[model samples]
Target: MSVVAVLRLPLAVDLSGFVKLLQRMQVPHRVSEEAGEQVLWVPDEISEDVRSLYARFPAGDPDQQLELPASGRTSTRPGFVQQLKASPITALVLLSSLIVAAVTLLGENLETLRWLTFLEFRVVGDYIQFTPLGDSLAAGQWWRLVTPMLVHFGFLHIAMNGMWYWELGRRIEARQGGINLLGLTLLFSLVSNFAQYVFSGATLFGGLSGVLYGLLGHCWIYQLLAPNPAYHLPRGVLVMMLVWLLLCLSGLVSLIGFGEIANAAHVGGLLVGCFTGLLGGLFARRKMAL
Candidate 1:
Protein backbone atom coordinates (compact mmCIF):
# COMPACT_ATOMS: atom_id res chain seq x y z
CA MET A 1 0.00 0.00 0.00
CA SER A 2 2.99 2.27 0.14
CA VAL A 3 3.56 4.79 -2.66
CA VAL A 4 7.07 5.43 -3.95
CA ALA A 5 8.18 8.46 -5.92
CA VAL A 6 8.96 7.45 -9.49
CA LEU A 7 9.71 10.76 -11.13
CA ARG A 8 9.99 14.44 -10.30
CA LEU A 9 9.92 17.46 -12.64
CA PRO A 10 9.23 21.21 -12.78
CA LEU A 11 5.65 22.19 -11.93
CA ALA A 12 5.23 24.09 -15.22
CA VAL A 13 5.99 21.05 -17.41
CA ASP A 14 3.07 19.30 -19.12
CA LEU A 15 2.80 15.60 -18.11
CA SER A 16 -0.43 14.74 -19.93
CA GLY A 17 1.14 12.48 -22.55
CA PHE A 18 3.18 10.61 -19.96
CA VAL A 19 0.17 10.30 -17.67
CA LYS A 20 -1.90 8.96 -20.56
CA LEU A 21 0.81 6.40 -21.24
CA LEU A 22 0.70 5.26 -17.63
CA GLN A 23 -3.12 5.00 -17.82
CA ARG A 24 -3.00 3.05 -21.08
CA MET A 25 -0.49 0.70 -19.53
CA GLN A 26 -2.81 0.21 -16.53
CA VAL A 27 -0.12 1.29 -14.08
CA PRO A 28 -1.72 2.92 -11.04
CA HIS A 29 -0.10 6.27 -10.19
CA ARG A 30 -0.67 9.66 -8.65
CA VAL A 31 0.81 13.10 -9.29
CA SER A 32 1.29 15.71 -6.61
CA GLU A 33 3.08 18.96 -5.92
CA GLU A 34 6.09 18.42 -3.66
CA ALA A 35 8.41 21.31 -2.71
CA GLY A 36 7.86 23.38 -5.87
CA GLU A 37 8.14 20.27 -8.08
CA GLN A 38 5.64 17.80 -9.56
CA VAL A 39 6.18 14.27 -8.20
CA LEU A 40 4.85 11.09 -9.77
CA TRP A 41 4.01 8.46 -7.15
CA VAL A 42 3.37 4.79 -7.90
CA PRO A 43 3.02 1.58 -5.94
CA ASP A 44 6.35 0.50 -4.40
CA GLU A 45 6.40 -2.77 -6.32
CA ILE A 46 6.04 -1.06 -9.75
CA SER A 47 8.81 1.47 -9.09
CA GLU A 48 11.33 -0.50 -11.14
CA ASP A 49 8.94 -0.81 -14.11
CA VAL A 50 8.09 2.90 -13.90
CA ARG A 51 11.77 3.79 -13.76
CA SER A 52 12.54 1.51 -16.70
CA LEU A 53 9.75 3.08 -18.72
CA TYR A 54 10.89 6.57 -17.85
CA ALA A 55 14.50 5.72 -18.70
CA ARG A 56 13.48 4.77 -22.24
CA PHE A 57 11.08 7.71 -22.68
CA PRO A 58 11.75 10.33 -20.06
CA ALA A 59 8.67 12.21 -18.79
CA GLY A 60 10.85 15.32 -18.29
CA ASP A 61 10.74 15.93 -22.06
CA PRO A 62 7.89 13.71 -23.36
CA ASP A 63 7.34 15.60 -26.65
CA GLN A 64 10.93 15.39 -27.89
CA GLN A 65 11.64 11.73 -27.01
CA LEU A 66 9.03 9.35 -28.33
CA GLU A 67 8.98 5.82 -26.97
CA LEU A 68 9.63 3.48 -29.89
CA PRO A 69 9.19 -0.23 -29.87
CA ALA A 70 11.72 -2.80 -31.15
CA SER A 71 10.71 -1.79 -34.68
CA GLY A 72 11.94 1.79 -33.98
CA ARG A 73 8.50 3.24 -34.72
CA THR A 74 6.43 5.32 -32.31
CA SER A 75 3.66 3.30 -30.69
CA THR A 76 0.26 4.72 -31.40
CA ARG A 77 -2.37 4.72 -28.74
CA PRO A 78 -5.77 3.41 -29.81
CA GLY A 79 -8.40 5.95 -30.73
CA PHE A 80 -12.08 5.84 -29.80
CA VAL A 81 -12.99 3.65 -32.76
CA GLN A 82 -10.12 1.30 -32.01
CA GLN A 83 -11.17 1.16 -28.38
CA LEU A 84 -14.74 0.26 -29.41
CA LYS A 85 -13.40 -2.51 -31.64
CA ALA A 86 -11.22 -3.89 -28.84
CA SER A 87 -14.03 -3.78 -26.27
CA PRO A 88 -16.65 -5.84 -28.04
CA ILE A 89 -18.88 -6.17 -25.01
CA THR A 90 -19.04 -2.39 -24.51
CA ALA A 91 -19.67 -1.89 -28.22
CA LEU A 92 -22.42 -4.51 -28.28
CA VAL A 93 -24.23 -3.02 -25.31
CA LEU A 94 -24.06 0.50 -26.79
CA LEU A 95 -25.09 -0.74 -30.23
CA SER A 96 -28.01 -2.65 -28.78
CA SER A 97 -29.31 0.43 -26.98
CA LEU A 98 -28.92 2.62 -30.07
CA ILE A 99 -30.57 0.04 -32.33
CA VAL A 100 -33.53 -0.27 -30.00
CA ALA A 101 -33.94 3.48 -29.87
CA ALA A 102 -33.67 3.80 -33.64
CA VAL A 103 -36.16 1.02 -34.27
CA THR A 104 -38.67 2.44 -31.83
CA LEU A 105 -38.41 5.79 -33.61
CA LEU A 106 -38.58 4.40 -37.18
CA GLY A 107 -40.73 1.29 -36.90
CA GLU A 108 -44.17 0.80 -35.50
CA ASN A 109 -43.77 2.45 -32.12
CA LEU A 110 -46.24 0.47 -30.01
CA GLU A 111 -45.14 -2.85 -31.50
CA THR A 112 -41.44 -2.14 -30.99
CA LEU A 113 -42.01 -1.04 -27.41
CA ARG A 114 -44.10 -4.12 -26.66
CA TRP A 115 -41.50 -6.43 -28.17
CA LEU A 116 -38.66 -5.07 -26.06
CA THR A 117 -40.27 -4.43 -22.68
CA PHE A 118 -40.39 -6.90 -19.76
CA LEU A 119 -43.43 -9.11 -19.70
CA GLU A 120 -46.13 -9.47 -17.10
CA PHE A 121 -48.88 -12.04 -16.54
CA ARG A 122 -52.39 -11.41 -15.27
CA VAL A 123 -55.38 -13.53 -14.35
CA VAL A 124 -58.28 -12.32 -16.49
CA GLY A 125 -61.49 -14.01 -15.44
CA ASP A 126 -60.90 -17.72 -16.10
CA TYR A 127 -57.71 -17.46 -18.14
CA ILE A 128 -54.16 -16.23 -17.72
CA GLN A 129 -53.32 -13.32 -19.96
CA PHE A 130 -49.73 -12.63 -20.93
CA THR A 131 -48.17 -9.37 -22.07
CA PRO A 132 -46.45 -9.10 -25.44
CA LEU A 133 -43.07 -9.75 -23.90
CA GLY A 134 -44.40 -12.52 -21.67
CA ASP A 135 -45.99 -14.28 -24.65
CA SER A 136 -42.74 -14.04 -26.55
CA LEU A 137 -40.84 -15.43 -23.57
CA ALA A 138 -43.32 -18.25 -23.21
CA ALA A 139 -42.64 -19.10 -26.84
CA GLY A 140 -38.89 -19.35 -26.00
CA GLN A 141 -37.74 -15.86 -26.86
CA TRP A 142 -35.21 -15.65 -24.07
CA TRP A 143 -33.85 -12.19 -24.94
CA ARG A 144 -36.90 -10.53 -23.44
CA LEU A 145 -35.27 -10.68 -20.04
CA VAL A 146 -32.49 -8.29 -20.99
CA THR A 147 -33.85 -6.34 -23.97
CA PRO A 148 -35.91 -4.15 -21.65
CA MET A 149 -32.74 -2.35 -20.72
CA LEU A 150 -32.44 -1.08 -24.30
CA VAL A 151 -35.95 0.28 -24.62
CA HIS A 152 -36.27 4.06 -24.25
CA PHE A 153 -39.50 6.04 -23.86
CA GLY A 154 -38.44 9.30 -25.51
CA PHE A 155 -35.66 11.15 -27.33
CA LEU A 156 -34.33 12.73 -24.18
CA HIS A 157 -34.47 9.42 -22.38
CA ILE A 158 -32.47 7.62 -25.05
CA ALA A 159 -29.92 10.42 -25.43
CA MET A 160 -29.29 10.75 -21.71
CA ASN A 161 -29.03 7.00 -21.20
CA GLY A 162 -26.82 6.55 -24.26
CA MET A 163 -24.33 9.16 -23.05
CA TRP A 164 -24.15 7.63 -19.58
CA TYR A 165 -23.76 4.11 -21.03
CA TRP A 166 -20.91 5.19 -23.31
CA GLU A 167 -19.12 6.93 -20.45
CA LEU A 168 -19.58 4.31 -17.71
CA GLY A 169 -19.56 1.15 -19.84
CA ARG A 170 -16.29 2.07 -21.55
CA ARG A 171 -14.60 2.77 -18.20
CA ILE A 172 -15.66 -0.63 -16.87
CA GLU A 173 -14.55 -2.32 -20.06
CA ALA A 174 -11.21 -0.56 -20.00
CA ARG A 175 -10.46 -1.11 -16.31
CA GLN A 176 -12.13 -4.46 -15.58
CA GLY A 177 -12.25 -6.03 -19.10
CA GLY A 178 -15.13 -6.46 -21.55
CA ILE A 179 -16.50 -9.68 -20.11
CA ASN A 180 -16.81 -8.18 -16.63
CA LEU A 181 -18.72 -5.17 -18.00
CA LEU A 182 -20.97 -7.46 -20.04
CA GLY A 183 -21.69 -9.68 -17.04
CA LEU A 184 -22.54 -6.72 -14.80
CA THR A 185 -24.78 -5.15 -17.48
CA LEU A 186 -26.75 -8.37 -17.90
CA LEU A 187 -27.06 -8.89 -14.16
CA PHE A 188 -28.15 -5.29 -13.56
CA SER A 189 -30.67 -5.42 -16.40
CA LEU A 190 -32.31 -8.61 -15.16
CA VAL A 191 -32.47 -7.55 -11.53
CA SER A 192 -33.74 -4.05 -12.24
CA ASN A 193 -36.32 -5.21 -14.80
CA PHE A 194 -37.69 -7.87 -12.44
CA ALA A 195 -37.84 -5.44 -9.55
CA GLN A 196 -39.72 -2.90 -11.68
CA TYR A 197 -42.20 -5.55 -12.81
CA VAL A 198 -42.85 -6.62 -9.23
CA PHE A 199 -43.30 -3.07 -7.99
CA SER A 200 -45.50 -1.76 -10.78
CA GLY A 201 -47.44 -4.97 -11.47
CA ALA A 202 -48.20 -5.39 -15.21
CA THR A 203 -47.40 -1.79 -16.13
CA LEU A 204 -45.20 -0.94 -19.08
CA PHE A 205 -41.77 0.47 -18.22
CA GLY A 206 -38.44 0.59 -20.02
CA GLY A 207 -35.15 2.54 -20.13
CA LEU A 208 -31.39 2.31 -19.47
CA SER A 209 -31.73 4.49 -16.35
CA GLY A 210 -31.69 1.44 -14.13
CA VAL A 211 -28.49 0.13 -15.64
CA LEU A 212 -26.93 3.62 -15.48
CA TYR A 213 -27.73 3.75 -11.78
CA GLY A 214 -26.17 0.34 -11.42
CA LEU A 215 -23.00 1.50 -13.18
CA LEU A 216 -22.92 4.60 -11.01
CA GLY A 217 -23.20 2.50 -7.87
CA HIS A 218 -20.58 0.07 -9.09
CA CYS A 219 -18.05 2.80 -9.87
CA TRP A 220 -18.88 4.71 -6.71
CA ILE A 221 -18.35 1.75 -4.37
CA TYR A 222 -15.40 0.34 -6.28
CA GLN A 223 -13.58 3.68 -6.09
CA LEU A 224 -14.32 3.94 -2.36
CA LEU A 225 -13.14 0.42 -1.48
CA ALA A 226 -10.24 -0.05 -3.92
CA PRO A 227 -9.11 3.56 -4.54
CA ASN A 228 -8.48 3.21 -8.25
CA PRO A 229 -8.17 6.39 -10.31
CA ALA A 230 -9.96 4.72 -13.23
CA TYR A 231 -13.18 4.23 -11.25
CA HIS A 232 -13.11 7.64 -9.59
CA LEU A 233 -16.23 9.82 -9.87
CA PRO A 234 -16.66 13.41 -8.87
CA ARG A 235 -18.45 14.13 -5.59
CA GLY A 236 -20.81 16.49 -7.40
CA VAL A 237 -21.87 13.80 -9.86
CA LEU A 238 -22.62 11.37 -7.02
CA VAL A 239 -24.55 13.99 -5.10
CA MET A 240 -26.59 14.96 -8.17
CA MET A 241 -27.54 11.37 -8.97
CA LEU A 242 -28.56 10.68 -5.36
CA VAL A 243 -30.60 13.87 -5.26
CA TRP A 244 -32.36 12.93 -8.49
CA LEU A 245 -33.09 9.46 -7.16
CA LEU A 246 -34.57 10.94 -4.02
CA LEU A 247 -36.62 13.37 -6.07
CA CYS A 248 -38.00 10.55 -8.22
CA LEU A 249 -38.90 8.47 -5.20
CA SER A 250 -40.49 11.46 -3.52
CA GLY A 251 -42.95 11.83 -6.48
CA LEU A 252 -41.60 15.30 -7.32
CA VAL A 253 -40.56 14.30 -10.83
CA SER A 254 -44.11 13.19 -11.73
CA LEU A 255 -45.61 16.21 -10.08
CA ILE A 256 -43.28 18.41 -12.10
CA GLY A 257 -44.35 16.75 -15.44
CA PHE A 258 -41.20 14.70 -15.88
CA GLY A 259 -43.39 11.54 -15.84
CA GLU A 260 -43.06 8.61 -13.46
CA ILE A 261 -39.48 7.61 -12.83
CA ALA A 262 -38.66 3.92 -12.44
CA ASN A 263 -37.88 4.40 -8.76
CA ALA A 264 -37.99 0.72 -7.88
CA ALA A 265 -35.71 -0.27 -10.75
CA HIS A 266 -33.24 2.50 -9.85
CA VAL A 267 -33.12 1.40 -6.23
CA GLY A 268 -32.91 -2.26 -7.16
CA GLY A 269 -30.09 -1.69 -9.66
CA LEU A 270 -28.13 0.49 -7.22
CA LEU A 271 -28.40 -2.01 -4.35
CA VAL A 272 -27.33 -4.92 -6.53
CA GLY A 273 -24.52 -2.88 -8.11
CA CYS A 274 -23.18 -1.78 -4.70
CA PHE A 275 -23.16 -5.39 -3.53
CA THR A 276 -21.42 -6.54 -6.71
CA GLY A 277 -18.87 -3.71 -6.43
CA LEU A 278 -18.15 -4.56 -2.78
CA LEU A 279 -17.54 -8.21 -3.66
CA GLY A 280 -15.43 -7.33 -6.69
CA GLY A 281 -13.37 -4.80 -4.72
CA LEU A 282 -12.75 -7.33 -1.94
CA PHE A 283 -11.75 -9.97 -4.50
CA ALA A 284 -9.36 -7.50 -6.14
CA ARG A 285 -7.84 -6.63 -2.77
CA ARG A 286 -7.33 -10.30 -1.93
CA LYS A 287 -5.75 -10.91 -5.32
CA MET A 288 -3.43 -7.95 -4.87
CA ALA A 289 -2.46 -9.16 -1.39
CA LEU A 290 -1.62 -12.59 -2.68
Candidate 2:
Protein backbone atom coordinates (compact mmCIF):
# COMPACT_ATOMS: atom_id res chain seq x y z
CA MET A 1 0.00 0.00 0.00
CA SER A 2 1.19 3.56 -0.62
CA VAL A 3 0.07 7.05 0.34
CA VAL A 4 1.08 9.65 -2.19
CA ALA A 5 2.28 13.01 -0.93
CA VAL A 6 2.16 15.85 -3.39
CA LEU A 7 4.18 18.93 -2.55
CA ARG A 8 3.82 22.44 -3.96
CA LEU A 9 7.20 23.87 -3.09
CA PRO A 10 7.88 27.32 -1.80
CA LEU A 11 9.43 30.02 -3.97
CA ALA A 12 12.82 29.19 -2.48
CA VAL A 13 14.13 25.76 -1.65
CA ASP A 14 16.73 24.69 0.85
CA LEU A 15 18.56 22.33 -1.45
CA SER A 16 20.87 20.76 1.14
CA GLY A 17 17.96 20.00 3.42
CA PHE A 18 15.77 18.50 0.66
CA VAL A 19 18.58 16.14 -0.13
CA LYS A 20 18.61 15.13 3.54
CA LEU A 21 14.84 14.50 3.32
CA LEU A 22 15.21 12.17 0.32
CA GLN A 23 18.02 10.33 2.09
CA ARG A 24 16.09 10.09 5.39
CA MET A 25 12.85 8.91 3.83
CA GLN A 26 14.50 6.60 1.33
CA VAL A 27 11.56 7.07 -1.02
CA PRO A 28 11.32 7.50 -4.78
CA HIS A 29 10.08 10.86 -6.07
CA ARG A 30 9.47 12.86 -9.21
CA VAL A 31 9.65 16.58 -9.79
CA SER A 32 6.99 18.40 -11.74
CA GLU A 33 7.69 20.43 -14.87
CA GLU A 34 7.68 23.39 -12.60
CA ALA A 35 10.31 23.18 -9.87
CA GLY A 36 7.59 24.40 -7.53
CA GLU A 37 5.88 21.02 -7.15
CA GLN A 38 6.75 17.36 -6.51
CA VAL A 39 5.15 13.97 -5.90
CA LEU A 40 6.47 11.58 -3.28
CA TRP A 41 5.40 7.96 -3.04
CA VAL A 42 5.18 6.75 0.55
CA PRO A 43 5.10 3.19 1.82
CA ASP A 44 1.70 2.13 3.02
CA GLU A 45 3.13 0.07 5.83
CA ILE A 46 3.94 2.68 8.42
CA SER A 47 3.04 3.80 11.94
CA GLU A 48 2.93 7.56 11.71
CA ASP A 49 6.35 7.40 10.16
CA VAL A 50 5.40 9.86 7.46
CA ARG A 51 4.08 12.61 9.70
CA SER A 52 7.35 14.48 10.14
CA LEU A 53 8.58 13.46 6.73
CA TYR A 54 5.39 14.56 4.94
CA ALA A 55 3.99 17.49 6.99
CA ARG A 56 6.05 19.65 4.67
CA PHE A 57 3.48 19.18 1.94
CA PRO A 58 0.86 21.88 1.37
CA ALA A 59 -2.07 19.52 2.00
CA GLY A 60 -3.78 17.48 -0.79
CA ASP A 61 -3.60 17.28 -4.57
CA PRO A 62 -4.96 19.48 -7.40
CA ASP A 63 -6.11 22.16 -4.93
CA GLN A 64 -4.46 21.16 -1.68
CA GLN A 65 -1.75 23.40 -0.30
CA LEU A 66 -1.01 24.86 3.10
CA GLU A 67 -4.08 26.58 4.59
CA LEU A 68 -2.40 29.88 3.55
CA PRO A 69 -0.52 32.74 5.31
CA ALA A 70 1.97 30.23 6.63
CA SER A 71 2.06 31.20 10.30
CA GLY A 72 4.07 30.69 13.47
CA ARG A 73 7.70 31.63 14.03
CA THR A 74 9.89 29.82 11.55
CA SER A 75 13.59 29.44 12.29
CA THR A 76 16.99 28.73 10.91
CA ARG A 77 16.03 25.25 12.01
CA PRO A 78 16.73 23.53 8.72
CA GLY A 79 13.55 22.72 6.76
CA PHE A 80 11.35 24.76 9.15
CA VAL A 81 11.20 27.98 7.13
CA GLN A 82 10.68 25.97 3.97
CA GLN A 83 7.45 24.47 5.29
CA LEU A 84 6.13 27.77 6.66
CA LYS A 85 6.52 29.38 3.27
CA ALA A 86 4.19 26.81 1.73
CA SER A 87 1.40 27.17 4.29
CA PRO A 88 -2.01 28.07 2.82
CA ILE A 89 -3.34 29.17 6.20
CA THR A 90 -1.00 32.13 6.32
CA ALA A 91 -1.83 33.08 2.75
CA LEU A 92 -5.57 32.83 3.40
CA VAL A 93 -5.38 35.05 6.46
CA LEU A 94 -3.44 37.73 4.62
CA LEU A 95 -5.84 37.63 1.67
CA SER A 96 -8.93 37.76 3.89
CA SER A 97 -7.53 40.72 5.76
CA LEU A 98 -6.68 42.56 2.55
CA ILE A 99 -10.16 42.00 1.10
CA VAL A 100 -11.81 43.04 4.36
CA ALA A 101 -9.79 46.23 4.35
CA ALA A 102 -10.60 47.05 0.75
CA VAL A 103 -14.29 46.36 1.32
CA THR A 104 -14.30 48.47 4.46
CA LEU A 105 -12.61 51.39 2.79
CA LEU A 106 -14.67 51.29 -0.37
CA GLY A 107 -17.59 52.49 1.77
CA GLU A 108 -20.98 52.47 0.01
CA ASN A 109 -19.59 52.38 -3.51
CA LEU A 110 -18.78 48.70 -3.11
CA GLU A 111 -22.44 47.89 -3.69
CA THR A 112 -22.52 49.36 -7.19
CA LEU A 113 -19.30 47.68 -8.21
CA ARG A 114 -20.13 44.06 -7.55
CA TRP A 115 -22.75 41.80 -6.03
CA LEU A 116 -21.72 40.88 -2.53
CA THR A 117 -23.49 37.86 -1.08
CA PHE A 118 -27.19 37.98 -1.92
CA LEU A 119 -28.31 37.35 -5.48
CA GLU A 120 -30.08 40.06 -7.47
CA PHE A 121 -33.28 38.05 -7.57
CA ARG A 122 -33.18 37.64 -3.80
CA VAL A 123 -33.29 41.37 -3.13
CA VAL A 124 -35.27 42.39 -6.15
CA GLY A 125 -36.95 45.54 -4.84
CA ASP A 126 -33.94 47.44 -3.44
CA TYR A 127 -31.81 46.35 -6.36
CA ILE A 128 -34.34 47.46 -8.98
CA GLN A 129 -34.63 50.91 -7.44
CA PHE A 130 -30.89 51.07 -7.03
CA THR A 131 -30.08 50.23 -10.61
CA PRO A 132 -32.89 51.60 -12.78
CA LEU A 133 -30.56 51.48 -15.76
CA GLY A 134 -30.32 47.78 -15.21
CA ASP A 135 -34.04 47.79 -16.05
CA SER A 136 -33.53 49.03 -19.61
CA LEU A 137 -30.72 46.52 -19.86
CA ALA A 138 -32.80 43.70 -18.43
CA ALA A 139 -34.87 42.88 -21.52
CA GLY A 140 -32.49 40.34 -22.98
CA GLN A 141 -29.66 42.23 -21.34
CA TRP A 142 -26.34 40.83 -22.47
CA TRP A 143 -23.82 42.92 -20.54
CA ARG A 144 -25.59 42.26 -17.26
CA LEU A 145 -24.50 38.71 -17.73
CA VAL A 146 -20.98 39.65 -16.68
CA THR A 147 -21.57 42.97 -14.92
CA PRO A 148 -24.03 41.64 -12.35
CA MET A 149 -21.49 39.42 -10.66
CA LEU A 150 -19.00 42.27 -10.40
CA VAL A 151 -21.61 44.34 -8.52
CA HIS A 152 -21.69 43.68 -4.81
CA PHE A 153 -24.26 45.10 -2.40
CA GLY A 154 -22.10 45.08 0.73
CA PHE A 155 -18.57 44.94 2.07
CA LEU A 156 -18.76 41.67 3.98
CA HIS A 157 -20.06 40.04 0.85
CA ILE A 158 -16.98 40.84 -1.18
CA ALA A 159 -14.69 40.01 1.71
CA MET A 160 -16.22 36.60 2.22
CA ASN A 161 -16.11 35.73 -1.43
CA GLY A 162 -12.72 37.25 -2.12
CA MET A 163 -11.18 35.63 0.93
CA TRP A 164 -12.43 32.25 -0.12
CA TYR A 165 -11.19 32.84 -3.62
CA TRP A 166 -7.67 33.80 -2.54
CA GLU A 167 -7.30 30.76 -0.36
CA LEU A 168 -9.13 28.13 -2.34
CA GLY A 169 -8.17 29.74 -5.59
CA ARG A 170 -4.51 29.38 -4.72
CA ARG A 171 -4.93 25.68 -4.07
CA ILE A 172 -6.92 25.09 -7.21
CA GLU A 173 -4.48 27.38 -8.98
CA ALA A 174 -1.76 25.10 -7.77
CA ARG A 175 -3.66 22.09 -9.07
CA GLN A 176 -5.39 22.83 -12.38
CA GLY A 177 -3.31 26.00 -12.45
CA GLY A 178 -4.71 29.55 -12.54
CA ILE A 179 -6.21 29.24 -16.01
CA ASN A 180 -8.66 26.49 -15.09
CA LEU A 181 -9.66 28.03 -11.77
CA LEU A 182 -10.38 31.35 -13.45
CA GLY A 183 -12.24 29.63 -16.26
CA LEU A 184 -14.44 27.60 -13.92
CA THR A 185 -15.20 30.58 -11.71
CA LEU A 186 -16.15 32.69 -14.68
CA LEU A 187 -18.23 29.91 -16.15
CA PHE A 188 -20.11 29.18 -12.94
CA SER A 189 -20.57 32.84 -12.15
CA LEU A 190 -21.96 33.78 -15.53
CA VAL A 191 -24.12 30.74 -16.11
CA SER A 192 -25.69 30.24 -12.71
CA ASN A 193 -26.05 33.86 -11.64
CA PHE A 194 -27.49 34.85 -14.99
CA ALA A 195 -29.90 31.94 -14.94
CA GLN A 196 -31.49 33.17 -11.70
CA TYR A 197 -32.10 36.71 -12.98
CA VAL A 198 -33.53 35.35 -16.18
CA PHE A 199 -35.83 32.87 -14.45
CA SER A 200 -37.23 35.40 -11.98
CA GLY A 201 -37.53 38.19 -14.56
CA ALA A 202 -35.22 40.18 -12.37
CA THR A 203 -34.24 43.54 -13.88
CA LEU A 204 -31.48 44.28 -11.38
CA PHE A 205 -28.82 41.89 -10.18
CA GLY A 206 -26.01 42.18 -7.63
CA GLY A 207 -23.54 40.41 -5.33
CA LEU A 208 -20.76 37.83 -5.26
CA SER A 209 -22.83 35.49 -3.10
CA GLY A 210 -24.06 33.40 -5.98
CA VAL A 211 -20.53 32.93 -7.24
CA LEU A 212 -19.16 32.55 -3.72
CA TYR A 213 -21.61 29.80 -3.03
CA GLY A 214 -20.80 28.34 -6.40
CA LEU A 215 -17.08 28.26 -5.57
CA LEU A 216 -17.79 26.74 -2.18
CA GLY A 217 -20.01 24.16 -3.79
CA HIS A 218 -17.30 23.49 -6.35
CA CYS A 219 -14.63 22.94 -3.69
CA TRP A 220 -16.88 20.80 -1.53
CA ILE A 221 -18.12 18.70 -4.40
CA TYR A 222 -14.68 18.21 -5.89
CA GLN A 223 -13.20 17.20 -2.57
CA LEU A 224 -15.97 14.74 -1.83
CA LEU A 225 -15.86 13.09 -5.22
CA ALA A 226 -12.16 13.40 -5.98
CA PRO A 227 -10.72 11.50 -3.00
CA ASN A 228 -9.68 14.41 -0.72
CA PRO A 229 -10.32 18.09 0.08
CA ALA A 230 -7.14 19.01 1.96
CA TYR A 231 -8.78 18.02 5.23
CA HIS A 232 -12.24 16.52 5.36
CA LEU A 233 -15.11 18.90 5.91
CA PRO A 234 -16.43 18.44 9.40
CA ARG A 235 -20.07 17.53 9.95
CA GLY A 236 -20.32 21.10 11.19
CA VAL A 237 -20.07 22.52 7.65
CA LEU A 238 -23.06 20.47 6.53
CA VAL A 239 -25.12 21.50 9.55
CA MET A 240 -24.13 25.11 9.10
CA MET A 241 -25.18 25.03 5.46
CA LEU A 242 -28.47 23.40 6.38
CA VAL A 243 -29.07 25.90 9.15
CA TRP A 244 -28.39 28.67 6.64
CA LEU A 245 -30.99 27.16 4.32
CA LEU A 246 -33.45 27.03 7.17
CA LEU A 247 -32.68 30.65 7.91
CA CYS A 248 -33.46 31.50 4.31
CA LEU A 249 -36.70 29.61 4.66
CA SER A 250 -37.46 31.51 7.88
CA GLY A 251 -36.53 34.93 6.44
CA LEU A 252 -34.05 35.44 9.24
CA VAL A 253 -30.93 35.88 7.14
CA SER A 254 -31.92 38.04 4.19
CA LEU A 255 -30.36 36.66 0.99
CA ILE A 256 -30.56 33.35 2.74
CA GLY A 257 -33.96 34.57 3.85
CA PHE A 258 -37.32 33.10 2.92
CA GLY A 259 -36.05 30.54 0.46
CA GLU A 260 -33.68 33.16 -0.87
CA ILE A 261 -30.39 31.33 -0.94
CA ALA A 262 -31.01 31.79 -4.60
CA ASN A 263 -32.27 28.29 -4.16
CA ALA A 264 -32.27 28.35 -7.92
CA ALA A 265 -28.72 29.60 -8.27
CA HIS A 266 -27.61 27.37 -5.44
CA VAL A 267 -29.13 24.36 -7.12
CA GLY A 268 -27.87 25.36 -10.51
CA GLY A 269 -24.35 26.11 -9.32
CA LEU A 270 -24.28 22.99 -7.18
CA LEU A 271 -25.42 20.76 -9.99
CA VAL A 272 -22.91 22.33 -12.32
CA GLY A 273 -20.14 22.05 -9.78
CA CYS A 274 -20.94 18.44 -8.95
CA PHE A 275 -20.96 17.45 -12.56
CA THR A 276 -17.83 19.47 -13.20
CA GLY A 277 -16.07 17.68 -10.40
CA LEU A 278 -17.20 14.32 -11.71
CA LEU A 279 -16.06 15.25 -15.17
CA GLY A 280 -12.74 16.59 -13.92
CA GLY A 281 -12.22 13.37 -11.96
CA LEU A 282 -12.86 11.37 -15.10
CA PHE A 283 -10.29 13.39 -16.95
CA ALA A 284 -7.75 12.70 -14.22
CA ARG A 285 -8.55 8.99 -14.43
CA ARG A 286 -8.17 8.93 -18.16
CA LYS A 287 -4.92 10.79 -18.02
CA MET A 288 -3.64 8.25 -15.50
CA ALA A 289 -4.82 5.40 -17.68
CA LEU A 290 -2.99 6.87 -20.65
Angstrom error at residue 76, model 2: 12
**How many backbone clashes can be found in candidate 2?**
28
Q: Which ten residues in a row have the lowest lDDT in candidate 2?
A: 58-67
Query: Ten consecutive residues with minimal summed lDDT in candidate 1?
Result: 61-70
Q: Pick the candidate with the highest TM-score.
A: 1
lDDT of 1 by residue, 1-290 (tens): 89878778898887777787776566799999989999889996566456656665555443544333434456787688877776788779878878988888722376566667677445578664666655677799787788889888777888888888888888787677788998999999999988998898777678888898999999888767666656778899899999999999999899999887899999999999998889887865554443
Supply the TM-score for candidate 2.
0.54
| C-alpha RMSD (angstroms) for model 1 | 9.7
Listed per candidate, the RMSD to the true structure in angstroms reads: 9.7, 9.7
